[model samples]
Target chain A: MTDLVKESSTQILAREMALTEQSVERRRRIVGLEPDDLARIAGIREVVLAQVDHFASVFFDYLSGIEEGRVLTNNRALTERARELKRSHLIAMVGGDYGRAYAEQRLELAVLYGRVGLELRVFIAAFHRLLRSIGEAVMKSTPQAPLEAFASFMALKKIAFFDIGVIVDAVVFERERVIRQQQDAIRELSTPVLQVRARLLLLPIIGVIDTHRARLITDSLLKAIRANRAKVVVMDVTGVATIDSKVANHLMQTVTAAKLMGASVIVTGLSAEVAQSLVALGIDLTTLNTIGDLQGGMDEAERALGYRVVSMDPRRDGAPLSPG
Target chain B: MPVPVLKQGSVLIASIQAALSDRDLVELRDDLADRVGRHRSRGVVIDVTALDVLDSFATRTIRSIAYTAKLRGAETVVVGIQPEVAFAMVQLGLSLDGIETALDLEEGMALLQAREAERVG
Candidate 1:
């Protein structure tokens, strides 16, 4: 379900994020990567290809040694799948085509790792150990020329950093998306419009009211008023921590809209601090029909709706019943 | 299409059927004003229940219709201004301030009757 909603594959995800060829070029420039670096990465392709299996085993060994990493590598099927993916990723690092395709591949892997609950820190630690082993193998292979091997290692390091940068971005992007979805859920949950009587509604607003939430509140309240044919609305804002001028203005607009729909809105339970701030902010309060508390607001709404609360017991009237 | 104005004794009730263009709105306003004068309606109720959007132009035209009818000795009560339409109007800073409003056709008639009673008594 998440995969469908979040864009299942790298192609769609890349397009959505605008990770085009031009953007990839821009990122390479930002990382100070040169044509020589690409050539060097490709040059070490054969050597790394031969040792990729060794690097994968070393990577798995490092992961199995760590407590947090064991949780991921314990499953035999998952370990075999991850080992194959890791081998391809190492080979791709030296494959030299560092464009949108390369970035998408790396992004796909990052997302996969993320789904399996691999923390970026753990992935980084294990990957770093593998890279070190590869660097040592390269230096040992080119024993005659220390400078050549060091150059290759440094070039590879730059690309590794670039890869890590993209992975970190992917992680942050996923987290932010989750936060936005959660915020939407909270916004929907926060403002509840309840029908109190035949022709009355009570909307208790609680939490921080951003512009989006304020708009939502107005939309839903209006719909509720229509649905219930509510003649009066008592909006209680005591649970709201603060009211800025913008929210105050939105409340006024909501009141005006309700009035236009033939419903009177009685704003109730404005905290002392919020009321004081509104006064201090010089917001126009004269148009707002504000009451001290929910009880008073309901009473006022009942009165406007012509709902007389009479005690069913005749004795409660404090007068003797007249006999025929 | 022309808005049909049904005369309910001393009151004129124009139930808007669908979204109206600017031209349609002007026609409705003029039609209501002419009918109110001819019928000598003591009250007029414009039911906007069907309107999904009440923009500034529509709001202004409705207000003008009410004022014109009022000058002809007819009190106008706008009825069934759908909640969404009303919210949109306020967001646009438009208001039907001088005219009275009622929840639906029934309430509009009740309000008109009460006013008539108050005037006679």
Candidate 2:
């Protein structure tokens, strides 16, 4: 009964066109529906309206009876709600008004459906059920008007095909966006400069130093130094597995820039491989203080500031000494 | 103008105040070498805290002064090298070859005395 009322041409056209125009101005300019396509689809409003409930009930009943949908005991209320949602979505689709809001809504649905772990095979099968049910519904309604009914049914299929293609694209786009966000977060975590002591910073490089990572290191380390008002920066590169001339040059520049900010730079953890590489490139690391490890660098920085640590009772701390 | 090389006891303090051109640095280098000889200085301290820039030419001049002072039996220490200047040298790969450095004037004076004692002992 509701489906028959929803099939009223004037009411359906008025609501769908209003929605389409409200957001048509600022929409993702995708493939569009021609006026002819809209007119052809609109001609079937009466047929779709008369059979909407039957088609929806057939699609939902089959979905709920299937093994995938019956995975859990879907309570009665939940099944009814899900059926209603599917019916409304089908009604909107047959309305034949697609725009950005339509695309965006599909994007949200894609994310939701992905989270539910809906298998593509199951979804494809469900869509086949939709086609058969709607086709059967329209055919039964217009048996005498065979030619008109076939054209209207084909128009419905065409519109549904376009929506499915958009859905697939939106799902892929959303998945890629998630991956890019994860990469960005990992990149941020990978490069970190810690202020280990007041006026002292420790940067421990833990992986390969590609050009992109190198640039990130420079910008972040420089910003950290200035922000901390640090007097010393001890860069520990023990974990850097392989380095080339380019990485070496970037490290050199970072050290230099840190110094320019009035902070003394001490580089630590120079592996034998890196040392040899530096020598081969004719790059000089002698001017900047290069220590064996983080501890040595820390000790050197503390001593430069005229402070030293000694175990109490067992050993004496820095004793006051006479200056020459 | 030529940079002045002032004498403080047995240590000669050459405070580089003005922006040094290539020519000025060369003249200062000669003048420093001459003054150390005349004063019979035991140590030379080149204070470069006021310098805004330290190009290759300036760094080379300072290194040469340190070498010349060494030959004249005076231990040389380049002191008060601002971090910015040091950074520039490192980027340029100057290395300030063979020049001893101290953090400040007091450290420079202390280093000079220590070297003197090492020699005497």
C-alpha lDDT (0 to 100) for residue A305 of candidate 2: 54
After TM-score superposition, the amount by which residue B38's alpha carbon in candidate 1 deviates from its true location, in angstroms, is 16
Question: In candidate 2, residue A155 scores what lDDT?
Answer: 72
Model 2 chain A weakest lDDT span, ten residues long: A315-324
Off by more than 4 A, model 1? A1-23, A137-151, A172-195, A203-229, A235-254, A267-287, A290-296, A308-324, B1-88, B97-99, B104-121
DockQ of each: 0.59, 0.16
- After superposition, the stretches of candidate 2 with alpha carbons farther than 4 Å from their true spots are A1-50, A54-85, A114-125, A128-202, A205-234, A237-250, A258-324, B1-121
Per DockQ, the best of the predicted structures is 1
What is the per-residue lDDT of model 2 for residues A176-293, given as tens digits with 9 covering 90 to 100?
7678786666555577789887878889887667667776787777667656767678899898776677777778777766654456789899988788988998877787799887
After the best TM-score superposition of candidate 2, give how far the Cα of residue B60 lies from its true spot, in angstroms: 9.5
